[model samples]
Target: MSTEISPESAFPGPRRVFQKLNEKPLRDDLIFYFAIVAVASVLFMMLPLLTGETAEIDGLHLIWFLVAGTLIVLVQGLITGAVALLAVSLVEHFFLLFVDVHREFEQTMKSTVYALSPLILFSWAVLLKIPFAGLLFLAWFCLSTFFGVRIFHEKSKDRAVFVALATGVVLAFYLHRAVGI
Candidate 1:
């Protein structure tokens, strides 16, 4: 794990980011996670206009679009993050009660955010008009959650796997609704 943390290096790629997430501090992952979300949200908000027919907008309209789009994306990202944190935390809290695994709320939140990387990409794909992107997103989401939960419960691999799968199952519906896919 690299101690030098920056959004670029910390989130160099999905695979690298997920791997580093297991080794890096929660604070660093939180920064990187939000940065990625912000960038993704902005790009997602721009996709329709970027991919659609060009529009005739004057300077004022263009400026307004940029400013309003940025604010909307950031606000949307914050709301989504809050919801995800609550959902993931609640799920983790519930499962932890049944299992003997010892982990903190911060750890669960960090892992959940990192696990959501694939879903973010899926949303990008949806914005880009990719075929069957929703299905792909679901697959990626399940795998990411499985491994993410597994990382925090190394003591009992069986229980970890079960909890992870359950998390995936429960989160799939919530995510599908949240992403509007």
Candidate 2:
């Protein structure tokens, strides 16, 4: 592990989780993702109830629809978040090597998870049905990654930007195509 990338120092406390994500534990990151997904699922399930939009469906059918839909979304969100985390970490690791930056694989993974925290907000934006929200979230995600890469490759801002953009764009495209955002 790099001396500068110690988890303890990188993430000293969680009061400012978004700012100090690099130091947070991987399990904590996963938990955060899961918590966000659960919250979004609840919001989605409650939308019809809150808005009284179930006029088209019968009572039993409406109940089933909301329950099943929430489960499907919850499962999909967890799967998507996990895959994206692993993929981003792997992509950043290889890209760093290509740029001759010798960062530990675990360190890169930690940074990648931290960089992806904005994705939680992205989910909320999606739940709110905001206009062009995916694009907005993508921009935030990319900016998060830019700073993350810069952190990992301290002396090479240009290389960091290159790696961050390359991998971030690929991930964004993947999400767009798979999630149909």
Q: State TM-scores per candidate.
A: 0.75, 0.67
Quick one: how many clashes does candidate 1 have? 0
- Tens-place lDDT digits, model 2, residues 1-181: 5557877667664334434665666678667766765675566556767767655777789778877888887787678667777888888787788888766676677667666766664565665666777777777666766777676445366887788788777877777843335
Candidate 1 local distance difference test against the native: 0.68
By summed lDDT, the worst window of 10 consecutive residues in model 1 runs over: 146-155
RMSD of each: 6.1, 7.5
Q: Write the per-residue lDDT of candidate 1 for residues 1-181, one digit (tens) a residue.
A: 7677888765576545456667888778777777777777787777767777546787899889878878988899867866766777678657756777577777677767767755664577765557777667766665665556666544366776666667766766666754345
User: In model 2, which runs have C-alpha deviations exceeding 4 angstroms?
Assistant: 1-19, 44-55, 124-132, 152-155, 175-181
